[model samples]
Target: MTSMIRMFSLAVTAMLFGLCFAAPASAQATRTWISGVGDDVNPCSRTAPCKTWAGAISKTAAGGEIDCLDPGGFGSVTITKSITLDCAEGIGGAAGGILNSGVPGVTINDPNGGTTPTIKVTLRNLTIDGAGVTQGTYGVRFLSGKSLTLQNVSIMNQGTGSVPAVSFEPSAASVGATLHMTDVDIVNVQNQGVYITPVSGVAVSAFLNRVTITQAAIGFKVEAGGTATLIDSNLSNNGRALWTASGAATANLEGVTIAGSLEAAVFATNGTTIRLSNVGLYNNAFGIKTTGTGIVQSFGNNRLGPDAGSIGLPTATVTQK
Candidate 1:
């Protein structure tokens, strides 16, 4: 047989030369994209996209989702897993952005510890610019997430290195970290525009709806094991527009609106606690300011706005049967 037909034609040419030196399978793409003239080596699919968001979050996948095909500045991103950076359908009407100056435009750290299950980040209709002048240290920095959602987001001018335009500081094992802001918008933040400090048996929690914190110097700050809640929010021109610092820190306001505070529009210190309903204390220079054994409770349908210069009276007035 002619040397067994030449050894079956050299074993089909050595199996096509080992399938042409095969080696291509580094999968990871549950949905990845980014544009503004994308090109991070393609494969971010949706027809070759990718150009920062740290190059399409390492090709997405791990609770994937990194959309936005039109509207750029997609830079600055440090999420570790569990993602979702939607541009909320403004694709062509221009939405997604990130013009940080020094650093930190979003950095949710997720190391995926022991039993896992700690990682959940979602940011929609983005726009986080820490205006220039070397401003920008945080426009979202939930260190080691367990939950952080911001809808219709917009964080601006984060005051150079003074930090805080959103910082749910977790760590200390990342205990129960959680924060949810809806229709959020924080502007001219120069520290504490939403800075819940956790880490020490960490038990942080924050929830603000229709939030809008402006010109902050402390427009919603909670420390210790932090806990905050606001509805129909609006803390404007702050210098201290609601702060519950230290220990059992807690703050809850309904139909909130503390305006033009040069200081004290509800501030509780040390062993904190603050609760008000139908809140609205405008032009405040003082209106419910407690210290040490701090406490401030009022359900008396609050609404003081005669350019409030001193309407402090609430250490317990809960008569809302």
Candidate 2:
């Protein structure tokens, strides 16, 4: 009996020793921090923040937020889960910045069955700069995501090959992705400022409020399976201010302004349609150009400048009730 009792005591002691020395599993934090002077190996806590946005994202929870500690170029990051990066409420009102070259400033690709398992992203109070010469490919390249909201965001100098400031081309699984842009400004983009061209048979929608696009090939382009509404927005000095290509693409403009377009102010082709209400077209080569059975319906409340090279008549003037 004494021998058995001694063996039992020894086993219990050994088990407790192993439990104490074993390493604890790593768990993501509900909130992570990033700073210019921080290190990536840190825990991303307030006192021990990470160095870059890419570093802190791995430490942050799926639906959590990563906040900036101060003014820093957090570097380019790829988001694969639902998260928010808010720099407006950080230590100072210093907006977070991303300076990218030869790559996208931000990429949001959230597929299903991942750890987070959601496809929503929000970006606020940031400036994405595609540095000149070796400029980045895209300011924001959204391949697969449910929705993306940009508030007070500025993207500029994306002079690469046919890359827009914001590209929303979702995959089949990411169909019906929604985009909301408020107080957003895009400048000097090589392609369209905002391109909403999803995959075939997949529809996407966009809402633009107080958005501005300047010095681009096209300000806003909506292709097949795409729809957009622009309110109180400005598209100026572009090859084409607004364009809807292919079938099933629709665009509505209200209280919007198109000025100094080298080509037509509004171009619709391939059975697409555009509706205008309370819109102003000034100093453009043409007010509205439609081809290939495309249509432009006006509510007769638009202001077209008399100096335009030509003003294409609307297919029909809609009567207000």
Candidate 3:
């Protein structure tokens, strides 16, 4: 017939040039699955789940992990690599893994750069609620991350003003940042319930275990040259529970417990530096206050009850242990 119709038009132009040169099947993925009636164009896997957490963190990969196959409200999320947001079981019915408002509720920026200079973020069993009315300031916001780990988390209310329920400032070409809070629980935070300021030759370090800070106005606030380590922690009804202000700040309270602070349960000022072991002070109005060139280093199995006292300068350093 005309050479079989020109060989059927050259076999349909070589099958449309092999379907336009194929190759399109990588959606990252190292482990990504979010539910609550998922569907972020599906592909988050695990039965095709993905509804939030910024759509399964772009199909997870950089240090992967975005599990939460059930609980829904997976909203707030702005992490940059080195991930892990394990909802630690119990999601939808709410047993950790809520995240409302979206003000912060998790925002760790990791400028890892080449050769992986550092980048690690692991938040497990979250429950960050800021229903104290439009909560959106901070409930976890560590800039330029290099390390942040919070287990069994639970950050509440979140002040609409001063804002803080875990806020670590690290950026100045960031080269230092580390925080590890275990069994964390910061309630009614309207200000400083863990706020470390570092950005002056950067350097921030923290490690609070069994942490718990209530109704904050300040329940752990390490300033500029940050450094902290509070174990078996608990700073109650705060208005000021444990503040190490200004530069050169440093704290190390072990087995800590400072109660009802209408102000000053342990406020070391500008030139701060504190270290108290086996500590415990009740009904604080001033259990260990210091100003200007602050310094307090008591370590004799402390338990300063009777409304506690130990005000300022003379560099109170009682160590009989």
Candidate 4:
């Protein structure tokens, strides 16, 4: 009986030893810390988290990620890696917001090496405010990438000449890419809510998926040669709701509501082909205005009634959580 008990005890001890060493490696993800005035030169641990956003960007491994928790989510940084940086709110990182009312939110410069070796970056559940500050650069900018998705994010009150809340700038060596922005709220931006410009015939695409814009000088501006989609969205009190510059681009505005704009809510300039279905156009200016040789084709219901102004389309539906 004594011999059997000793053998069993030894087996249990061996098992526990194996678990202890393996546990740390399994949970060995890097946890970078942040202070109210954190900079990049510091060690990225909880106690020695990097200080500046630029600092954290340098430590992120190519395709690795780093989340920063601070009192102000400021600074300009370039991304060439597959990273998920959530300074405001997201899982696996910080869940509180520190974006001051008057500061730069984030500036994303694309890979300067001509080719971007990274994959996708998903930023969700954050608030970015550039309240009449300096030219805030951009809330988020992408030059070369496979995919980029922004969900449940807010970009409000950027400076007077700040770029767009979200911008996609394609490279000449780029094939094509997609930017999926869903459930985004942009207001009081001087330029645009979401902007995209393909590299002359580079064929990149931009999708303002489920975006809501209020009080923007220009709402969703699809520059020349960029194909864009505005689905299930609301643009109110803008200079122009959907501004298209190129005729080569196509805009499908379905289930959208535009009220009180300075100009035509939807302006299809150049040779742009704009399709509208079940869309509502309200007072202040022309609802669906197209200039030049651009074509505005409507197959869906445009007029619902005098009191009712809303296009009922499934793709244009937005349910806030």
Candidate 5:
């Protein structure tokens, strides 16, 4: 009947070109899985999983990986590219897999004249809980990434007022950004527990290992041309534990433990530079406070004070061990 109606119009034009080439090859899934009974239109599959890390980061694959197959709360995620949000194994530990009350439980905005100019983010074993319930100003708000890695993470009670539970301020096109925190724990953050500001002329760097900054008003706030390297860290009961400000800020504290700081366990101001090794300044009212032309370089196996107050500047230098 006219050659079977032109072979059913050439099989409906090859089934509409195989459904437009299989819908972008199934939306480019390099790896994507998120389950707490997932269903973000079911394609984020490790058996169709997807129940938020903003729906498995829109079916992940730009440098993909979003694996968390058991515990839930996986909300609040605004990472633009280069991803890896691994909840290492024990899926539901911190009150059943949470990223509570969120506004920023992870926001790494990457996209400025793209061709993947930067953007590298990796967060593992996550337990970001702001259940003290203002629910987020930041528990990782690195506003434009080049690199940010946090392992065994636990950023607690995120701040609302002065906002900082890991906020590496980067946006002058994400200026020289880099931060790597291992075995991290930033607790009760109501102001500043790791806020490395880098946007004036780009120079941000941070490397903290075995970190812990508790009860923060300010524990590690390295501003202005920043640089920080704290190992085996613990800055406790903070009003201000380590605050290096303005001029070319640099803080390299090793084996640190600054306790009960009702202000200043090392507060280097304007012309900042603080380098203390094997540090432990307990019950701090001021174990090391250097003013406007600040500099505290003590590399002694440091353990200062019963009733601490050591103000230095005879061109501050101490090398006792």
Candidate 6:
């Protein structure tokens, strides 16, 4: 009888141990791998990495992660899902950085199949060099998305083909997207530094955090109902530094510097609401121009720079050709 009791006690102890000490079998997010020399058709495992950004982007699940086996050799990736490309070590190292300059850089492919793609990518600690190739336009184009967040990524030397440096072309209102750019430096765009063209959905907001846009046709063009927020940015050496057509844009400027424009520094029209906070403007022409009932409210720490022009009070609101 004592032996039987011992056996029962052992079985009970084993069950209790399994319940208290055993780890729950939880699944982890899957990761895909990419390399400068990889196969797009192969499995995206660490041993056999994928070839193109388009391939990895299409394969990666929304909540999954993708890591580059070595420094990535980019060839214009189109995103269609939610994935994180951990580019912490930088793309090409000291000799040369990742090239998105010629042909197509990062194209947003939506018309592929199924529903339109809404890609959420987090690119951290990577230098995306455009190599002064402006033919095919844009270093990074966020065409259609639910929302885009670019953190600590540098997009330089875009627009060889008279295309804007960065183009945010949304699909429709049902798929209205927002672009949140953090610490992005856009330089040497021929036509425009940042261009937003609406297809069906005209509502778009572009937020810039510590961004510098220089040597372009226009610094920022807010077309239709497009809105932009500039924070700690430098806009210099452009035709109409900031042009707002359709008077449908709303701009919030904070700690921004605008310099070197042939015409008005900030050309606003169509009842646009332009709010300035600690802003600085130094244009050879008029400081600010407002037409069609648009208003530039000089609020809180906003000051016209040393080379900035006067408002001309009541008469100078409208720009003269």
Best by TM-score: 2
**What are the per-residue Cα lDDT tens digits for candidate 6 across 1-321?**
999999999999999989897754432326777777789776666777777666666566676766766665556766666666566543322211257757657665444322555556565555566774234457767666666666677666677777787787776641456778787777767778887665553687888888888878777887776788989988887777777766467777888888877677777787676777777777547778888787776654666655786543322222322
**Ranking of predictions according to TM-score:** 2, 6, 4, 5, 1, 3
| Candidate-wise lDDT, in order | 0.83, 0.87, 0.78, 0.66, 0.79, 0.68
Clashing pairs in 4: 38-51, 39-51, 39-52, 40-51, 40-52, 40-55, 232-316, 247-271, 247-272, 278-311
Q: Encode model 3's per-residue lDDT on 206-262: one tens digit a residue.
A: 888989999888888888678889998899888889888887889989998888888
TM-score of each: 0.41, 0.91, 0.41, 0.76, 0.42, 0.76
lDDT of 4 by residue, 194-292 (tens): 777766656767677678898877888776667777788888888877777774877777788878788767777877777777677777466656667
Clashing pairs in 5: none
lDDT (Cα, 0-100) at 39 in candidate 1: 88
**TM-score of structure candidate 4:** 0.76
Candidate 1, 1-321: lDDT as tens digits: 999999999999999998788654656787777888988888777788877788888878888888887876777889888888887553333467787888889888888633343889898889998778688878888877688899898898885668788888888777777899999889888888888998773787898898998888888889888888899888878898888888998988999888788988888886889999998887778877897689899988988867865886788988888
Once fitted onto the true fold, the runs of candidate 1 whose alpha carbons sit more than 4 angstroms away are 1-23, 29-31, 34-43, 46-67, 71-111, 114-152, 155-172, 175-221, 225-234, 237-240, 245-266, 272-282, 285-288, 293-308, 311-321
* Model 5 Cα lDDT, one tens digit per residue, 115-218: 23387988888888877446566888887778889988888888886789888887766656789999898888889988898776468789999899988889
Residue 282 lDDT (model 3): 82
Runs of candidate 6 with Cα error greater than 4 angstroms are: 1-29, 89-98, 111-118, 132-136, 174-176, 309-321
Decide which is better by TM-score, 1 or 4.
4
Off by over 4 Å in 5: 10-14, 17-35, 39-41, 44-49, 52-55, 58-154, 157-173, 176-192, 195-218, 223-236, 239-242, 245-247, 250-266, 273-284, 295-321
User: Residue 181 of model 4: what lDDT?
Assistant: 83
Flag the better candidate by TM-score, 3 or 5: 5
Q: What C-alpha RMSD separates each model from the true structure?
A: 13.3, 3.2, 12.9, 8.8, 12.9, 8.1
How many clashing residue pairs appear in each of the predictions shown? Answer: 0, 0, 2, 10, 0, 6
